[model samples]
Target: MIILASASPRRQELLSLICDDFSVEPADIDETIENEIELEKMPEYLAVKKAKHIQGNKHFDDIVIGCDTGVFLDGIMLGKPSSESNAAEMLRNLSGRKHKVITGCALLYKDRCISFSQTTEVEFFELTDMEIEDYIATGEPMDKAGAYGIQGKGTALVKGIVGDFYNVVGLPVAMLNKKLKEIISNAEKKL
Candidate 1:
């Protein structure tokens, strides 16, 4: 069985494009970014951690997938907003600036584990305070990293993007499908 260690509806929707049969078993683990982890690698580290937490010897024969995403601007990582004000601050900081959206993914099957991250450069149009306030009121940015959802109403805030569009939505479907196919092919060869 394929098990996805996430409860995100967006992730679930994306993963369905790669695999038809799978189960959602959101991993329960501390997501705090450790100081030891480099800013660029934090997402991958968290993804691996979450996947390992869910594997735990119980899903030895199953393919377990975990993912984590973060938005980086000016060398700092912007995670999910804690409140509306925080979201507004993030939007203001991102106004007319370019940032990166990185999604780290992990796939585990028995002793084999594969992990990777995809980065997308996104540029936001110069935003006014009123625009930021209006977007925040939509409530879409509250639960999203970088205080914006590229796939939702927040699209109006972006000027351009250079990379996998799906990555910004929280998953890199093409890369993930490729990695999953490779793992499944190798597993079949061994059998």
Candidate 2:
């Protein structure tokens, strides 16, 4: 059985584009970036942590997938905002600038694990304070990295992206699909 170790509806929706057969098993862990992990490596670190956290309780053959995403600019990580004001500030900083959306994905089965991170460079049109305030008022930026959801109402804010568009959405479906195929092929060979 395949399981998703996340509570994100966006991730579940995104995963559907690649595979429909899976279960949700949200992992509760300290998602804070550790001092030892570099800013660019936080997503992969957290993703593996989340998967391993879930792995302890599942069947050996049950594969669990975990993912984490963050926005990075100038080597600093932009996490989910703490309040409306914070969201506004994040949006302001991203205005008319290019930032990276990094998503780390990990798949665990038995004692084996495979993990990778994908990054998509996204640019935003210069946003006015009124526009940022209006977006925040809609309550769409409250729980998203970079205070924007490129796949939702936030799409209006984005000018363009230079990598896998799905990576900005949350998961890199193309890469995930390819990885799963490899796992399945290897499993078949073993049998």
Candidate 3:
């Protein structure tokens, strides 16, 4: 069985694009440690941590997948907003700027873990204060990293993205699809 270590609906939706046999078992971990890791390494590190946390209880035959995402501007990582004004501030910081969205994925099977991160360059259209506030009113940015959801109304805020569009949504489907195929092939060879 494939187990997803997340509570994100976006991740569930993205994972469904590649695999149908799976269940969610949201991992409980203190994300505060992520604040200490280097910006570029934080996502993958957290993904591995989450997967490892859940794999401890799963059967050896079960494959556990965990993922983490973040929005980076300049050199600082922008995580989920804590409040309405925080969300607006993040949006203002991203406005007219090309920021990076990184989604890290980890797959744990048996005693082995494979992890990687996908980075997508996202350019935000110049937004006015009213635009940011109005979007915040809809309450979409509060739970999303970087205070925006590229898959929803936040789509209007993006000018264009340079990598996998799904990465911004939460998961990188193309890379995951390829990785899944590789794993299946390896398993068949072992058989």
Candidate 4:
């Protein structure tokens, strides 16, 4: 069995593609970035924190997976927009520019763990204020990192992506599928 330490529908849906024996238990770890940590390392830090937080109080021995996703433009992290206005601002900042979407994942099974992060470069076409406002009105950016969901209404805001599309959607399926296979195969050896 596997346990996903997040309530994100995107993550839940992604993990579902791999296994049906997992349960959702969103971790309550503080997501604030450390003052001294580099921007590029924040995602990995949060992923590990979330995984360990849930792993520490385990009442069962199922494998646990924790993940975090963030968008960075010119080194500044764009977290989930706090409001419609904030979503517009984030989209405006990303207009006609390229940003990096990074997702970090951790897999824990008892005393064993594996963690990794993947980054995808996304380019947005020049968006007018009307376009941003219109996109925001669609109500798609509220729950997504970088104020957009590549797999939904937010696709109109993106011009192109230079890396894994699934990463932008919150999970790198190709990479995650490989890791999950490894975990399951190893777990079988101990069975």
Order of candidate numbers by lDDT, starting with the best: 1, 2, 3, 4
Task: Return the lDDT, model 4, position 67.
Answer: 91
TM-score for each model: 0.98, 0.96, 0.94, 0.94
Which residues of candidate 3, in runs, are more than 4 Å off?
Answer: 34-36
Off by over 4 Å in 4: none
Taking every candidate in turn, the Cα RMSD to the unseen true structure, in Å, is: 0.9, 1.1, 1.5, 1.4
**Per-residue lDDT for 1-191 in model 3, tens only?**
78899999989998998898899999899876645678878888999889888988754567788899989998999999999989989999999999999999988877677788999999999999999989999999999999999999999999999999999998999997887676666656766
Candidate 2: residue pairs that collide:
none
Candidate 2 regions exceeding 4 Å error are: none
Query: Which lDDT values do the candidates have, in the order given?
Result: 0.95, 0.90, 0.89, 0.88
Query: Candidate 4 residues 1-191, lDDT tens each?
Result: 68888898988898888777788889997787779978887887798789888888772377788899999998798899999999988999999999999999988887788888999999999999998988999899998888999999889888999999989999888898899889888988998
Best of the candidates, lDDT? 1
Give per-residue CA lDDT, model 2, range 65-157, as digits (tens).
889998999889999999999999999999999999999999887778899999999999999999999999989899899899888889999
Q: Provide the clash count, candidate 4.
A: 0
Instruction: Give the Cα error of residue 21 in candidate 1, in Å.
Output: 0.6
6-95 per-residue lDDT for model 1 (tens digits): 999999999999899999999999998788999989999999999998899488898899999999999999999999999999999999
Distance from true position, residue 135, model 4, in Å? Answer: 0.9
> How many pairs in model 2 have backbone atoms within 3 A of each other, for residues 3 or more apart or on separate chains, i.e. clashes?
0
Best by TM-score: 1
Model 1 deviation from native, Cα RMSD in Å: 0.9
**Over 4 Å off, model 1:** none
